[model samples]
Target: MRVIFAGGGTGGHLYPALAVAEELSSRDPGFEALFVGTSRGIESRVVPASGYGLELISSRGARGKGAAGKAVTGAMLAAGTFQAMGIIRRFKPDLVFGSGGYASVAAVCAGWLMRKTVVLQEQNSVPGLANRTLAPMARRLYLGFEKARGYFRRGAPVVVTGNPLRGAIKPGPDRDARKDFGLSGDGPVLLVFGGSQGAMTLSRAAAGYLLRRTDVQAII
Candidate 1:
């Protein structure tokens, strides 16, 4: 099987796409997997690190810019679309899978145009713009949240698959985390991590609000 996965911009999108690629490889050892992503995004690093050959297309989003910037971004997007087509023509994948990002946008569109099956994974409570735009062209759309299904048009592929996670860490609830952290029960417990979605703002606010609370015990 020849499979191509195009996704990037964040680990949330890239990780699941990679997981699917891994599964595909396991199902068929003869499978050939290729990843398409922007040279600028995190996918360039993460995709190759996952041991897949990555084809980089030039892509940039239009945001917080004037008309000139938007025009330039549009031109870049069009050019990258052509580049994606080129990749598809050369690779001739049987199917293409992606998550969500500008990178996925170009590749999925090209794959659809080339008469290849396209599968997309939309992994958020609210589907991202790229995934939504590419949804109609997709043969299958895997979703993380069920509520997001209505957003797609009629006959669009919508599968409610819970979030695909990797290298998950689940600390036992009965493990007595207080003892592990050497904490006292006199004060509230505050946990902070920078990487979680919308986490920084919530973590800071939670830390500030609960640090003074003498009764709360939780994880953030």
Candidate 2:
């Protein structure tokens, strides 16, 4: 089966698609996958590195924009949708999967317009604007958090499937994992990360906590 996976801008929006593609490839050697995203998105680098074909579309975030900016964003989204439609036509994917981001808007919209099977995967507790707007077009909506269900339409096809993890991520021996981080002690170790795109708030909070508790070794 051929699938078109669309989403990017951050690892949070991109990695889940990669994980699903990896799993499908593992199960069916003949399965083919293509990724659609903006050139500026993380998918530009991540998708090719993961050994998948990637098609770039024009897109920009409309959030935090003024009237003029929103107009420009709308133009870009229209261009992106046109480009995505071309890609979809040429690729003829059996399914189009959307993870949530500005990059997903065009491809998902194109898929819906073409009457293709469209699916969405939302990774946050609060659904993003793109996913919320495209939810009705999706054949199925996979959510990372159960609480996210309430945000969608009452009868929407929402399924609480936790975020997909990459095949490369696997738990190893505790000592080995600690050693990799240069921590040899048996003391408690803390892992702090602000998702794929680092958050200033999380960084500041973690710093304050670490300062108060020097006993805890953290990998940020």
Candidate 3:
């Protein structure tokens, strides 16, 4: 079956969505999955690298310097609804899965309007606005935290799947990856990753502190 994943403001949404994709892949290698997110969201980068096709749309959350700004953004989102419908028609997916993003609202709504199955995966302790609005209309809801359920509207069946994560993300020894980065293997080693997808400042601090130690060897 074909599936589309929507929602991606942060790693909170993108990461969980990817994890679910990975799980489906493990279970059925032939399942096709596509991801939909704003052109600027982290998913544009992470999803492709993970071997998933990504469809882009112009969408931004409601924000403004004042009420006027929110009003204009709301107008854009309204237009985006039709744009999302076009995507659904072209994709012809059996199911649409929403992760979390303003872009997703349009896409999921269009899918629901078409009577295609729509599933929501809530990643935060509190369900975000897009999911909240779509919950009543979706066919199924999956949440990272059960506590988030009380926040959704009635109608959809809810399931607690925890946060879906790609199997490629593993916390373990870096002996293999280290060899590729061109570093000596004599001292204490630390892997530092920071960007939109992680806690860069904390990793930087920890690596810096470790490097200063007389016993330690390196940081990545």
Candidate 4:
């Protein structure tokens, strides 16, 4: 089967699509996958390295921008929709999967316009704007958090898939994990991270926690 996985901007959006692509390849050797993302997104680097065909399209975030900025982004997105349509026509994907992100917006919209079967995966407690916008067009909506389903319209089948995570995230041997962090493995281990670029708020909070608790071992 041929598939197109669309999403990017951060690891939170990209990695889940990668995980799904990896699983599809593992399950079916004949499965082929293509990833569509913006040239500026992390997917530009991550997707090709994972051995999937990567298609770069222009995209921009609409949040926290002025009217002129929004207009520019809107034009970019329209151009990206055409690019995505061309890619879809050439790839002839059997399925199009969208992980919620600004980068996925055009691709998903293109898939819908082409009358292709589009699926969505939302990775946060709150559904992202892209996913909400495309939900009506999606054949199925897969959610990382159960609470997210309430945000969508009530027609599509929603499944709580608990986020398709990479194999590297499995429960590690605490002793080994601690040793990797240069800790003695005698206390609790805290794993702190803010999405892909790292959140300053989370960093500050983690720093404060670490400062107060000398007994804890953390990997940040």
- Candidate 4, residues 14-117, lDDT tens digits: the string is 99999998888889989999999988889999888888899999898895568888889899999999999999999999999999899999999999999999
Cα error, candidate 2, residue 4 (Å): 0.5
| Best lDDT among the predictions, by candidate number | 2
By TM-score rank, best first, the candidates go 2, 4, 1, 3
How well does each candidate superpose onto the true structure, as a TM-score? 0.83, 0.93, 0.74, 0.91
> Residue 8, candidate 3: how far off, in angstroms?
0.7
Per-candidate local distance difference test = 0.82, 0.93, 0.79, 0.90
lDDT-sorted candidate list, best first: 2, 4, 1, 3
Q: Is candidate 1 or candidate 2 better by TM-score?
A: 2
Instruction: Give the residue spans of candidate 1 off by over 4 A.
Output: 167-197, 208-220
lDDT of 2 by residue, 1-220 (tens): 9999999998889999999999999999789999999889999998999999999999998855588888899999999999999999999999999998999999999999999999999999989899999999999999999999999989999899999998899989898888889996678998887854447788889999999997899998
Q: How many backbone clashes does candidate 3 have?
A: 5
> What is the C-alpha local distance difference test score of candidate 1?
0.82
> How does residue 90 of candidate 4 score in lDDT?
98
RMSD to the native, candidate 3? Answer: 4.8
Per-residue error for 135 in candidate 2, Å, reads 1.0
Worst 10 residues of 2 by lDDT: 192-201
> Which is better, 3 or 4, measured by TM-score?
4
